[model samples]
Target: MKREMEDVVIVGAGIAGLATAVALKRVGVRALVLERSQGIRTTGAALTLFPNAWLALDALGVSHKLTRSYDPLVKGSVTNINTGDVQQVLFSEQAIRPVHRKALLEALAEELPTDTIRFSSKLAAIESQEQGGGASIAVVHLEDGTAIKSKVLIGCDGVHSVVARWLGLAEPVHSGRSAVRSLAVFPQGHRLKHEIQMFVDQQGKRAAFIPLNDREFYWFLTCKEENMTGEPEQIQREVLEKYAEFPSIYLDVVRHADLSTISWAPLMYRHPWRIIFGNLNKGNITVAGDAMHPMTPELG
Candidate 1:
């Protein structure tokens, strides 16, 4: 199907895509956002957005509504899951609060005009054309058989992005590690403080819990050299069994975790050097966020 030409075509409706679209709109640039999924993907996890993230959101006029103070960062605890050794670590007293993934997405979307996003429009392919007069154009193909041509194209399609692949970026390098994450809610309410807690076994098995509020906490477990994969229930079971030997406090977190929210994925990243020298864009097309730089969550 033929669609109207757009000024900018942004692939993916995640934070990066929506933020880009909103920012472009500030300068009288209209963007068409195409999301592969039927709706926004909410993983039921909380994210501690740093200062830079907030600053950018503010620039796009989205921060005022999302600017509510959350629990401040104080001391974080790291434990030796095997030897029972605990180390208390001090964190920056910054306002880096853990916000829910759904809330963050909704806040960003709210600032955008209604119908700015088109769902189930997964990118199929991209073709670059050398338009004369020093102007370039991109023809974007969607899985749904709709083709759109735009003067500029932005790739926020995330890791394993079709746009990134079309750009001939390097292959993803697996770290040979797998991670599982979930949120645990205490209906009776937890009495824990606002600090973050982490435990690591000698073999690189690690688990962490960050309190979102007094009644709920977010948690994740990581194991090295694992190729575990299956249904959601199987993934949750693997997470439970991997940290089965940890102290009751940790096991309790896993026990109380919402099984539906539990998820597992092997760690993978593009080599940093490749990212530094990688061909990010061709013609009028470029990428942002994971499509540009995807690092481990630990580095953040």
Candidate 2:
């Protein structure tokens, strides 16, 4: 079969892949992004972008677009359910905003050229070939029976990245904990302060509420990994039951959560030592983002 040729090929169109493509485009380097899904995967309800993250976004030229929509949170309070003690924490002068995943994806994708992202393109296997003169090329094969040759192959594919595995990276190990996240929509406006609120029990199970906007907010709960399977409704109920002693506001958030936004999964991470000593790249192939270093989400 005839093989197509390109300068750079990026696998996975998640936050990392899209951002890398935009960064390359700014430097006059065009990259083709391959996504296994049909469209942008906006499964994670939202993310808290710190000052450093915003600086990177600013470098990419998309921070203003997001800043206009989401306001920065400057303070938060953590409550201990076991002791009924609340502690207040203040943030520095830098901006900290929590944005919806969909909006963030769209913002980064907007900076790309037309057809820059190829959806429904799943990476099957990869091989490196010598092109003489001590040069090499990466041959990427897709599940659909198409082959593409590129000067550089970057894997931004998430935790289960095939490229990382091809490079002999160890599999991600479970972190002995599970998390459930979702967005709660308040149609008439939530009327809540623009601050983060968290509650923790004696068992170290924690729940947090973060306001995304006046009409919607993002919330998540982390606990010991148990039988957290089944439908969104079931998961929502589980959260309610598990944290029944939490503040009523938390319960309300879970009760009014958008079912489609609910996501439950066991946290996984690649050992840091392995990443420090393992083969992250070979020839012109390399990995980035979660494909390179995946860790449990503990930023709070």
Candidate 3:
């Protein structure tokens, strides 16, 4: 196979990969992002960006674009479904914004030069060679029978990262839980408060809803892995049936959910201890984002 050379080769074009590439570009370094998918992968509905995340985006010089689009959440309320007890908490001066996953990906991707992201490029294997000065070069082999060499190779390929495994990192363990998420749209107007509302039942099930904008909001339900199954429509019905006792407001949001955006998956994360003592980097190869430390979304 022919060989291509790049200064930096980043695997995966998700949030971390794209953001890392944009950050490098800002500092006069060019990188090539390889994504296995055909295009940008907008799998999840939205993500909550805490103060630190915004600072990172700001450093990347793309926070303003997002700040203008997403409103900061000032407070939130958590309610116990069985006890009917509610706890209200106020946020600090630092802002916490919930943004559409797709928007975030696009914002970072826009900052890079055209053709910076190469879709349909899957990493099949990784190798490295020693060089002068005791440094090393990374060789990334793609599934398409092409090989690329780079001075530095960063893996942002997510929980199932091939590079992470190559570094001998343990696989992400299942949290014994699954979640169903979707974006609910109210074209007329949701007219809901710009705060987060969460509900938890005694059965270890938890759910939360957060407004993304005036007309759209994000919501998710966490339950035992065995509790959810089948197609999107079936899952939608299951949500309604399983949480029939939840507040009418939550059900209303479910009713308005855009089925096309509904997604279901088991939650997985790396053990904290493993991350604290694992081989995060070897030679010119390293891992970042979910590849390094994937955690349950609820912890976010």
| Lowest lDDT block of 10, candidate 3 | 223-232
Candidate 3 structure quality by residue, lDDT tens digits, 1-300: 889999999999999999999989988999999999999999888988998999999999999999899988999999999999999979975589999999999999999998899999999999998888899999999999999999999999999999999999989999998989999999999999999999999998899999999999899989887656688888899999988999999999999989888988899999999988999999889999999999997664
Worst 10 residues of 1 by lDDT: 64-73
How many residue pairs collide in each prediction? 0, 0, 0
For each candidate in the order shown, give its overall lDDT on alpha carbons: 0.81, 0.92, 0.93
TM-score of each: 0.93, 0.97, 0.96
Candidate 2 stretches greater than 4 Å from native:
none
Please write out the lDDT profile of model 1 over residues 1-300, one tens digit for every residue: 776688899999988898888888888888999999999887636676677877787788866665563566677889996787889988666546677777788888877788889998889899987888888789998887888999999999987888888888897777777778788889999898888889998888888888888888888877786656687767767766866787778778777887767777777788888878989888789998878777666654
Task: Please list the residue runs of candidate 3 whose C-alpha ends up more than 4 Å from where it truly belongs after superposition.
Answer: 227-229
Candidate 1 Cα outliers beyond 4 Å, as residue runs: 67-69
Best by lDDT: 3
Query: What's the distance in Å from true for residue 295, model 3?
Result: 0.8
CA shift of 104, model 2, Å: 0.6
Ranking by lDDT: 3, 2, 1
TM-score order, best first, reads: 2, 3, 1
The alpha-carbon lDDT assigned to residue 125 of candidate 3 equals 99
